[model samples]
Target: HVVDELALLSANIVEVVHDRLSSNVRAGTTGVTLSLETEDQKHMDKLIQHLKEKSIDFKVLT
Candidate 1:
């Protein structure tokens, strides 16, 4: 059940990111970079792992 919850959470995060990017584009913001950060690296690790398990590609800039 944890995995399922993670999957849903990850999906929601992706959607929010997508919406932000879309809004930026509509506002003529180009060459914008998006970054995700966590105060605790462990949470970032878990999120990255969940994204990878679902075949999503992401880069950690830290």
Candidate 2:
């Protein structure tokens, strides 16, 4: 459900880069490192804000 929500939030993103090197699954939760690339900075900010609103822990990798 969370992942689907994430997808919806990132619908405007042009591409999503998945960090397979650091992605993994734990006991109950799976960790997914994604870098979203978008032409509009506002869209990026909206996505990040949505993630925060959903209480999803995430780190921006640059």
Residue-by-residue lDDT tens digits, candidate 2, 1-62 = 55676678655434545443443645555555554565477877887788789897788776
| Candidate 1 residue spans exceeding 4 A from truth | 1-33
lDDT of each: 0.52, 0.64
The model with the greatest TM-score is 2
What's the true lDDT of residue 18 in model 1?
33
Error of 2 at 48 (Å): 0.7
Q: What TM-score would candidate 1 get against the native?
A: 0.43
lDDT of 1 by residue, 1-62 (tens): 43464556553232223343564355654333345444466777777787688775446555
- Give the Cα RMSD of candidate 2: 4.0
